[model samples]
Target: MAKLKSLMSCAANRLQQASGLDQTEARIEIRALMQHSLGGVNHAWLIAHGDDTVTDALRVRFESLLARRIQGEPVAHILGRREFYGRDFAVTPDTLIPRPDTEILVETALDRIPPDQACEILDMGTGTGAIGITLALERPHAQVTILDYSEAALAIARENARQLSAHNVAALHSDWFSAVQGQRFDLIVSNPPYVEADDPHLQQGDLRFEPITALASGTDGLDDIRRIVAHAPMHLKPSGWLIIEHGYNQGEAVRSIFSGHYFANVHTVQDLAGHDRVTLGQLT
Candidate 1:
């Protein structure tokens, strides 16, 4: 039987060989699996108990998870939750795993709308409800409505809203603005499907397990964005802001769409990697 540290080292080496991840990243993945499967044992605990023998059951679970990771499954998917904006959100195959880039949208939305004011917010294609729920929790006075075309996705979002105790949020089934007809919002945000249908990257890595509808838009990956942009003005109050997460390469196209629609203050915000990740504009 391998000791805890030996098992971790072996797992990390295998992960490095399988995924081309550096030693540091591989160790991080190993630590995450250990923490998740070993009664929430953290990195520090693993280090402290380096000489401890690995339990058969725990080792089996870790090996299973490592095999899934070797096959390109995302750790968030394997763990069944993702952390976003200082909170953990339940995620499943029905929804896109909330990414750190999307946090910029939440931050931007919060910055635009004052926390003390009563605000009506719409999260298009809300997925796991990360953006909408986080906004509701951050600004308790805000009423957030999250829409998703998929009932399965909406269910996950609703559950996340419940788990997170976001009382100000409501999840609904809507194809864009269809279900919310005639309702206007102070702000609208989305992390929609912007990956091109034929993007080769979709066939690789974590994208394989994620729902295609939640990841791909069209040949240009702008179809859903176009739909949202066209309908957003109708659902947004005058002077209301609309912010969206898009593919890094889609920034110029997104900015053009907003500008062409006569939206003022149109601009893109870069993520931590300095890649354009979010675009925002205000209704005239």
Candidate 2:
């Protein structure tokens, strides 16, 4: 018992010093590692009885995970789960992390779609199944189709749908609208790759771990957004809504794209941070 505590304390201290995280974060991560090693036991149970000596095998496993986390790996990837829209989702390197800004797009879409009406929604580049699955779960009457270019990402999205019990969602492997030709949607939403290829932020933090194709959009970062706007009218019902998340500086450009396409009620929504993170337009 005493030996296990000593080993954990030592590892936590080393991780704290090397990673520069605060003491609280370091302790939480180390305890999470211990809990993971104990067959996914609750943190409270582990804290109450963790002093009990663990097997040598468990100690080795804990150390391996700690080492990996110290190397700048995202904890969500390490734990294989990310929480989105108040739901836990399985995630992997193949899909992008579900960001909070995306919730605005979801909320806006829900507001625009009539609950009593059976609607079809198209979520382009639906990584991790966050947007489409959330919509399906929120509005059971709605049928959602999620499209992604990467087969691996689609696999992850499918798993998330099954895990979330979002049976109304249909996952497809498509580059934009290729797989759903001749189908029309009442609402079309996307958070496509909007980061410019030359953005320095891409080389820092968790962005460094995400796939480039899921982050960068040509040289201007608006290439995918442009393509989506140009093609959305064809797939949308006459009055369908098109909502999208983009960089804060992209609101004007996105609004301009919608204006050029003759969309009505084109406007931008600010995220919690007060940045213009989402833009919406109604097909005229």
Candidate 3:
């Protein structure tokens, strides 16, 4: 049997060659695969136990995962979980993997919700329940409703909410606002499908493994955004806030939509990449 350190180094090299990832990212993937296969080990533990011998059984398990990744299955899907805003959210093929960029949506929503107030928040198209669950945890007093059209995706989100003990969050199935009917909320946020149907990125990288219905919109990728903006006023309470994450190049168009709807203080916020990622406005 090979030493654990040597086995890990070989796996990282194979991952790097297959995925074109840098040495740092390759090592991270190796660490995640190692932990998943070996069990009971974290990054710190792996570093401390590098000299441990790799048993034949453990080597088989580790290589199986690495091979799957090399063949293009998403790392999150393979691991059955994803980390978002310091919480581990269970994810599957039915649900889009929670992304780091969406954390900006949660942070912006946090600014709108008070720590002590019993605010009503809506998370539309919620997948993995990351945004809603994180907000519910952060503001224990706030009630968050997470809505999704896909029952399978909703199952994953509900499970995540349960595991995270987000008691203030409720999961509902709806094709948009159909289930809410006459109800309204003080705040509504979403990370809806903003990728153009023909966008080449959909066929590349981890995107290839994600559900297309959760990623692609209309030809220009503004179909869902337009529908959400048009219908949001109906559900938002007086002075309620509406925030939505969109494609980077869509800042101008989204801002214009909000303005046309007579929303107040309409503007766009850049992500860590400095791309216009989230746009928000208050109900007039």
Best by TM-score: 3
Off by over 4 Å in 2: 1-34, 43-57
Per-residue alpha-carbon lDDT of model 2 for 190-243, expressed as tens digits?
989999999998997678888899999988899999999999999999998999
Write candidate 3's Cα lDDT for 1-284 as tens digits. 68999999998999999999999989998899999997747888888989999898999999899999999998999999989999899999999999999999999999999999899999999988899999999999999999999999999999999899899999999999999989999999999999999999999999999999999999999999999999999999999999999999999999999988858999898999899999999999
TM-score of each: 0.96, 0.88, 0.98
Kindly list the per-residue Cα lDDT of model 1 for residues 1-284, writing each as its tens digit.
88999999999999999998999989988898889988787678889999999889988999999999999889888899888988888989888999888889989999998979898999999999999999999999999999999999899999999998999998889988999999999999999899999999999878889999999999999999999998899999999999999998999999999998869999999999999999999999
Error of 3 at 54 (Å): 1.0
lDDT of each: 0.92, 0.89, 0.93
What lDDT is obtained when candidate 2 is compared to the true structure?
0.89
What TM-score does structure 3 among the candidates reach? 0.98
RMSD of each: 1.2, 2.6, 0.8
Q: Which ten-residue region of model 2 has the weakest summed lDDT?
A: 1-10
Best-to-worst TM-score order: 3, 1, 2
Better of 1 and 3 by TM-score: 3
